[model samples]
Target: MTHVITYDIGTTGLKTCVFEITNQIQLIGSTTEGYDLKILENGGAEQDPNDWWNAMCLTTRRVLQENHLSPEDIQGISFCAQMQGLVLVDKHGEPIRKAMSYIDYRAKKEQKEGIGNGFKIGGANIVKLSKSLYITGAVSASVKDPVWKYKWVQQNEPENFHKVHKWLDVKEFLISKCTNKFVMTEDSAFATLLYDVRKGKKRFSREICQMFGVKMEHLPEIIRCTDMAGKLTEGAANELSLKEGVPVFGGGGDASLIGVGAGAVGPGSTHIYFGTSGWVSTVVKKRVLDINHMIASIIGANSGHFNYFAELETAGKCLEWVKDHLAMDESNLYLEKNQISEEKAVVYKNLYDYMMDAIAHVPAGSNGVIFTPWLHGNRCPFEDPNARGMFFNIGINSGKSDLIHAVLEGICYHFRWQLEAQEKKVNTSPVIRFVGGGALAPITCQILSNVLNRNIEVVEEPHNVGAVGAAVVTAVGLGLLSKIDDANQLIQVRDRYTPDPETKRTYDKYFPVFQSLYKNNKKAFEVLNSQ
Candidate 1:
């Protein structure tokens, strides 16, 4: 057993968690620090690399300090972070400019335009097309991938393009600051849509890189997720107030780590996660791609497996949107009209909790209020950039509680669709290991159970699951554990939820109509969104 430290840098902020793992898992402590995301009017999203570093240092020191533990007590450090975002850094590991996020779709124009060597899918020749599918398992016509951003920068910001020395994902950039080594884990490399994963050949594709006009030297050295990146440097350790030579492991992306954290590391294991964005992911032994549905398998945190991801672009974020924007104002107005004190109106303050509590009292299907949770289009069951969120079958009787209830149901319906659609390509176990910030809510987990009609196990410390998974990978790398599968034993399931008959009946009625919304609006989505 060893005490491992893991840093999970997510879309909203950075979290540092300390875990003690042996035959059973225990989360000793965790601290989080928030950072701002810059969203431009031109469909750009960016964040400062330094802000992430500052948050990392702050949380790392806080977790260690509050626990009264010395840095030497920790065996290894690892990470999980927002993936697919492109962070370009100089030779010294300093960022050349603000990093672009995965949600940034500003590069869409460049994505469709032809690149050198016929790089992107739409621009690719027959040879390039055949090789990309065979090796990488998928390529996108959307700007979601970094390769497209690389093309975006060349045509839009040539100065930034020329100054780039190396391209790094969020985790790789952090690891470089820690070890002073410019290296990337295979998982992050694969997400760039630039690496080759034709089983047994784990290398970046030179032909693909050349086609996109990417310099081979601009990419960092590839290493296994469980491999040791290096010892933490003195300068880095000083910033975090950690031991100078603690070993750092190459951690994988957030999705893969969340899989391991929820005890879904076995080749056929499956789990569902609800974060800012969410997904249903399963572990597989080989590269599996459902190009028609846009579900792609990326490298798993476990050294030898792949995580089949059915991604949903918006999941828990919809709740946040409603909580802050829709309900907060109403909650305040209600309090004032009732003459409730700020101290007495406690329920009104915690908007998310109030919504969940409200939803718990409402029947499934939200009394015939149906919502489509496609706030940011959708990523699974189908790929569409123009899809929009909608509320249907609502009457004057429908109130805030019904709307909130419908949003939760709508998201579950989406997952139910994912479960059905993905099962055609990969074997998804009937039981799901649920983990994420949203999994803590009984209403959310229960809805998931009812809609998917599967037994669900909720993680004890749901928010820390991502960090636990990264720490588990570090444990395997440090020889504290024999293999990644040991994570199954270390992760504990706190509770289980079974489907409710009455709730399932309501969902059964609405799920079909929910599925049809996209088809009904497909033409409208394209037309209304066309520039």
Candidate 2:
């Protein structure tokens, strides 16, 4: 079987998967390798570029060997990574320092230091914001932007900044290692906030680059997701157990590719991704920018399509935190009683099973409880770094299950908020294609569907959507597929969760309260955080 390979570079690990492309795509094998994400006390998140490369080599070799495939079996390769981070490399393509992850907020001070400011009310020059939005459809006024981090290195690490030959996102950096050509996908450029994503002119905005004192030359050439960037170099090929000249396609950022993988490539169709982070996004026909609400678009999997991204910083992570701290030691309990290995115990005795049993018993509205899922601050519907997670109106009757249910419902409420915004600003479909780690839970999908009052469909192998997208685009590059949308046949809906009228009625009452809670606490969030 002719196969295509895909690499999903995420915040916590790198996943490599292989898919066979005949009349339809079929997953052959997949594996993941983990790496450390250094979350500094001062609100910094960084990852080693070498570690990323190491994980790629490890996962690729393992997946290939397990599948009993040879180097020549794979025809094409593509990649997508968690977007909105900076990876600076020297002239020889050696990383100058650790990469700033998309969630990294170390540039907060840098946002006020000089022209690097990326957030309004954070020392950003007013004229710069107007000019940037006019030319680029985005601006660097947000510290979390890669441009702000680029400027941070310029101000704080001037020596390394001067040595920097180019700045690439996770996707470009990984592809460069294989192709020996430093290039970026259009989607990656849009995430940089320095690109002119204006409907007619899409390129590095010279004006914004000048305004931020970032040399346009430091940016790599932009290419479409299906473009054949270059062939695998001898060193990379040997490391990956692949052919020396295997073609590598320019796969896009995770936001767009995930939609393609979920079989939501058509315009106005939307998907909700819940991973280490979360967002509500849809494919659109035109570029969109609502700077006031911080709602925007990056390049999508399809060339002319725009991906309207309403980002939420903390979704699954909030649940993860709760599971790690609040949930009982199920693995240990099984280990002591059954004498099973820790890994096997974890696999056989699922934590979600435990939580879901209790959560299922709890009624809607979490027994009059509410949760705010801004554990790491927020980026969509509005950008507020000062915002934080909160559980409101708790009483003596509240139990662990109610709290757990509250967290799940809280995340769904936020999705509804973003969906409403998209319905007004961008065309959002009534049904949502749900994919990611959170969607693995049937209870989570049901809660989201009821809260949003829409159908939530889960496709087979939801967690692997990103890989599917990359594989499909690689197939497109290799002429194995007609277009991205042709991937629909390869996807199968595992189940669909419909809104229960009674539960939807309850959520309708609580959703408005959820909206007001954020606004009522907005200034207080800033003031308390400032102190």
Candidate 3:
């Protein structure tokens, strides 16, 4: 039986899996490896490209060895990576500097000028710097379009920019390492702020490149997501324990692949992902740009398709921070009282369970308390980088559980805001499919369902959806599947959560207050940051 090997290179780690083509299900053989993102002061995020390659090699080797399969058993390999990271490479494909990740805020200075001063491009002024430059054309032309983090590198690190040969996205860098092919997918290319979304074509926008002082030849050739980029070279194959000549399909950004993997294809199908960041996206037959341009519309996985994605800059990360900081005192108390190692493990689980139970007991809307989930910044509806999270209506009676519930509700309120904006643009209200680490939390999923007043379908195998999506793309590239719909039929839905009517009604009342908090506090946040 033929199998497809897939890699999902996410922000936190690499996940490698082998899927059987006939059943369209993942086999038992899989491996995982962790990777770290270097966070610098002033919200700068960087990573060595070699770390991804090394993790890919180590995990691939382990998967092969654990499965006891020969390299010849694998048919094809493809990858899905985090979107919008900027990597500079030399002519020989060697990385010139650490990759500037999507999370990095060092470009805030450039972004501020573009959005704050109302820089106009294509005959319109963009209000939010990050959104305007990324979605609109208020960027420099010299460096393959200044909408990318590359512009920040050019202005801030001139010496490093001078040595740069080619600019590649994270997935493109991996493809170059595996097959020596420098190619990019449309999904990744559209995020660069250079691609003309209306035209559905990609090239180094000479207009923007000139502004940034970069040449067009510095960019990679853009291709469709399903295109056969190249074959695995002997060296990469040997290192990963895979066969040479195995076709490497042009994969896509994690969001696009997750949409495909969750079967969120065709019109009206939507998926909401909650990881470090939160996103709500829906597939459309054609591009539908918002009138206000509040949400980002980008190229979808399939050719001639498009997706509208609304993001909340922080989701799970907010919860993680609360757990780490607020729960530390409780954690230490439990640890000191617990005697054995096994008891200590139980204590940790009990603490988390207690927190969830407390959150579950709290009524919908957290008794009028609201959170913004803008710990990182606002991504959609507001698009304000200066946006700060707030816990409004907190009282002396409010405890840790109320605070936790409020945070979760705040994130849900943001989703509702995006959904309302989306409904105005699209005629339909579709059921939402949940995928990613956040879906694992039952309380959070239930809260989302209550707030959105829609059924939420959580995939049983949420963690591997992106990897599975990549394998499905590989299958299509290799002629195993004729259309994406065929692959969709093979996908299984494991669980479904329905919203409670009472909870939904409660959330309906509180969502407006949630909206007002941001409006009233926006200027305050900006002023506070300025100081």
- Best candidate, lDDT: 2
- The TM-score obtained by model 2 is 0.93
Worst 10 residues of 2 by lDDT: 114-123
TM-score of 3: 0.89
RMSD of each: 2.7, 3.0, 3.8
> Could you tally the backbone clashes for each prediction?
0, 5, 12
In the range 256-296, model 1's lDDT, one tens digit per residue, is: 78988888888778898889889999888877877667788
lDDT per residue as tens, model 2, 1-531: 578899999888899999988887788899999999887766678999999999999998899899998898888899978998899998888899999888887778767664443455333566787787688776676668887788788888999898999999998999999998999898888888888876677889887888778898899998989899999999999998899999999998899799999999888889999888899998888778776667777678787888888899888888877787566545575445534457755764576655776588899999999998998778878777778899998999998788899999999999999888877787788889999988988989999999988899999999999989998899889987878888877888999999999999999999999988889999999888642
lDDT (tens digit, per residue) of candidate 3 on 1-531: 578888888887888888887866665577889878887766667899999999999999888888887888888888888888889998878999998777666676665444334565432344333343543333222111225477688788889888888889888999998889889888887777666554543554665555434577877898878889899999988888788998999888887898888887777788888877778888777666653535656777866566777777678778877777665455576665433357555664645555676577888878767787888556577556567888888888887778888888888888888888887777444578888877877888899998998999887577678887887788888888876667788777888889899888888899898899878988888787531
Clash pairs (backbone) in predicted model 2: 118-140, 118-141, 118-142, 119-141, 119-142
Lowest lDDT 10-residue stretch of candidate 1: 114-123
Q: Could you tell me how far off, in angstroms, the CA of residue 407 lies in candidate 3 after the best superposition?
A: 2.5
Candidate 3 residue 114 C-alpha distance from true site, Å: 5.2
lDDT of model 1, residue 69 = 91
